[model samples]
Target chain A: MKRFTRSLGLTACAFLALCGQTQAADDIPTIRVGWSIPAEEMKYWMMRRPDAFPDLGKQYRIAWTQFQGTAPMVQAMLSDAIDCSSQAPLSLGQGAASGGLQAYVLAQHVGERKGESFSVYWAVAEDSPVRSVADLKGRTVGVNVYGSGVYGQMAMILKQNGLDPERDIRLVETGFPGSEAALRAGRVDAAVMNQPFALRAESKGGIRKLFSLTDLMPNTVHIFEVCRKDFTDAHPELVKRYVKDLRTAMALAREDRAETLKVVSEVTRAPVDLLDGYLLTDKDFARSADARPDFEAIQQMLDQYQQLGMLPAKVDVAQFRRDDLIQ
Target chain B: MSAQAILQRLGAPLTVLVLLTLWELAARALALDGFPTATESLAQLPAILFDGQSLQSIGASLARMFAGIGLALLVAVPAGLAMGRNPTLARMLNPLLSAAYPVPKAALMPMVMLWFGVGDLSKILVIFLGVSLPLLYHSYHGAARLDDKLLWSAAAMGMRAPARLLRITLPGALPEVLLGCRVGLAMALIVMISSEMIARQSGAGDLLFNALDMALYPDVYAMIVILAALGFALDWAFEHLRLRLVHWAEPRQDAASGGNS
Candidate 1:
């Protein structure tokens, strides 16, 4: 009887100790970060290269959630499902304004840097008569989404070439995976394609790029990291640690391209052969060394979107911009 | 079992083998960039099933699918029976159901996620929405055709309204309810996969998209095969249960207007 009583007391003590540890750990915030596949989100792969993020487990931990697109990611933020995610400029404007979400930009993920980086392209078959944006007029073009950044870029190029994007081109919504197939099938004259797909098409030797996003919006911040206002309000220090770790990870990813692709391959399950020599190189979208979000470029994109009658109302980027987080 | 029955049992598997063979031929002939041969896709199946993450994802998806169907069964069956019996209730709900019928349930994922968060509840709810309509429609038709004389006889025996509903209407409508369940079962899987694909978080659908996004052609086709196999297995098991439950009901097949009782 005495031995049984002693064992029960020990178990009770152990349970109490565990509860105390949990309580202490709860004080350190774990940020729920959202990301999509094929975009090469560096922070999502940070755990694979733990040495890159010094403050990963010490100051803050990340609970990464994969999403299909930025639209759903924004929905997740609105519902408090995720605290932050890497968002495109168009989505950022729409999500904040429509959802009444106080989403703040923390740091840039990928963008055009001095016109020496990869951007989305509208490519056609090499034998096709279409050689420029104007030539695409009265032709059926393929876009992944109507209002996505890629689509916005395509629309801007079309407008500059004096063609109505809505009237002239019958924009078929071909998903990124099916873009090459759709183009090769003669279903589309040109398809707006992003990294890896663009690289794959290039390597295959039939597609000819007419114009890229850079041709229209030079030095554009295509994607940037964003956090919910509530998360930042409650856990400012955690957000700061996250930014610091993100910057460190970005710098390391830039330095060791081979190692970075290995981690990306592990996370995405894309064969390293497909990613190597292209991803994180000059062929990929440029990542800011210090992880800075360009407020001016973001505003310019929003203004252009508003002017093009895409956005319902004008969104001043300053309302959602947070310059304090990007150190 | 007799020889005829044995051959009948073997028919589906034989068809599957033939289809796979044809796929192999077509893929090899085309030799498209991202399309993989049938053998290559089948070779990837073992790896996918054995992987811990993949199994967990699929398991989570199945859990949600079942939960949604179970919830629909609980709510839709009784409501459909009541609607079937009462013309007023049927009149009220018919238009609403008709309106919602054409709206793809998967398209509601974003709004559902916004309301319920990107958790199991939201996914289950969308699957429930997808499944409920078919179950309700079939169950209502089943109950509507329940011989009024049989119900009247039960009433003459001093059976209360609720008791008659439980005892007579439920069993009478069950075959149709089960048929609805069969359709709902398929709808459940469709909604589950599509919602997961749209949400792109975790599940069989997410796994499929992940493979697609990564351009892992073999893995993509392998995931499709797994989903197809899962749908087939579930349908076969449910069909067996359905047959056993409605053994006395005269064999009836679906038609353009309605099936003969």
Candidate 2:
């Protein structure tokens, strides 16, 4: 009986020790920012520069986490596991309406105006009769899952080209990388592609660039930087500093075009010369210190995508936008 | 071996053609807005396949895959064989493997990134972790199932310990060991795609994610076909090798085993 009690006490002590270690892990000073970057890829692409962050992560601190997919990043922010990051604005808006996360749109990547469209193109075999997005009606078009920003952008593109995404094109969520390969294997007629990927598909002779999303939705659909409201409540200055530094980085990317090309090339592993032509949005990234994100324009895009059944109608997008986090 | 078998061998192309025809019908007849009409998807394949960048990415994926699997086998086989031979050693290391074995390697991507900087090393290690334990379990089980009397008889014949292990123990465990290899190979391919999807800058997995990001459905399909082909070839080769190497250990019901009887 004595041995049993002694062992039970020891077991209790061990469990307490483990609990203490986990709590200490939480207490360690960290700015737990989540980004939907492959961590290795980020180290290769963004952080190689000394000035990418002030004092190179010394002044404040960082505990950067990388998520495999944007969905998890969305969940992490809502659950308070993360404080700040950029994610698909469409998901963020819908998530906010449902009370899953309390976040607000704070920044933008202004690529749409400059022809730097984060677009999905209706591509076909070069010799095929499909000429533009119009010709693609009644054809299978690939997009990511329904609420994903990729589909919203694709829907806007299709709508502009005189085809309703709901009535004209067959939408299937075959998933990434697989979608492109499916197109080439003749499993699907056309799939949307991102930039380096679009460039990649074009280099192959069989596929032709049918139409880009920019041609359809110009300056309407884009990526956003959303922050957890509670984090903004606590470290407002840190968030401001992050924005100030990012604005400068975007500006540096433009003014020092040659050096920027070199850095992006090394980071992206694209040839430096090839990355030279890669597009950037100045109005979004190189914001004037006093400038605020264009929320009305953003809300319009959100509402359009929402009405298109791309985002939830329940999201009061006004609440999704917070000026509190803006520097 | 027969004409009917030959007909079966020629079925793959016919199947693909039949599938294409049905796809064409679906788009034409159903006015399907949800899928690509047949002809557009087929004509896009060849041009996408010959891409220099795409080919390079495939080659990169293959190289890393082999590197990860090869290093895992080198460590796993010998270590597993040793643990299989000695219960004392197995007991000592059992907890280490058990504690980690159930932790899904995919969930550890963030921790892996923190420690290994999200490079090739991290990716390889993640795949390695997923493969090694299954191989170890197989090795240990294979050893335990060995015919003890055979080893005893070999020792009675004055066979040296090393010679007995090589001639009797190894041959006895091979059937189970090969089964483990089949699983390990499939698992390796799966982890390769998952790791690339989660963490890497390039590879077929990266290609798929980028394709999704861009909404190039055709290109996404093309990558899927390539990865599928790669997996099929790997599995087929392993099966063929298994049949050839372990022919002597054919199941009791097989023609070879009957001949031996």
Q: What is the interface RMSD of each candidate, in Å?
A: 1.9, 8.1
Write down the TM-score of every candidate: 0.88, 0.55
Model 2 per-residue lDDT at A230:
80
Off by over 4 Å in 1: A1-28, A47-61, A97-99, A162-170, A312-314, B1-9, B85-88, B147-168, B250-261
Docking class of 1: medium
True contacts kept of each: 0.65, 0.11
Across A274-325, the per-residue lDDT of candidate 2 in tens digits comes to 4544434321222222334567656766776677876656566687665655
- Using DockQ, give the best candidate's number: 1
Per-residue lDDT value at B146 in model 2:
87
Instruction: Give the alpha-carbon lDDT of every model.
Output: 0.85, 0.65
- Candidate 1 lDDT over A1-327, as tens digits, reads 999999999999999999999988886669988887765456755857766666777677787777887888888898898998979888878887677878789888888865578877789999999977888878989998877777876788889999998899899998777788889989999987877777878888888888887787788887788999988988888888888778878877778877888888777767788888578778888887787888899998998888777777989988877677775
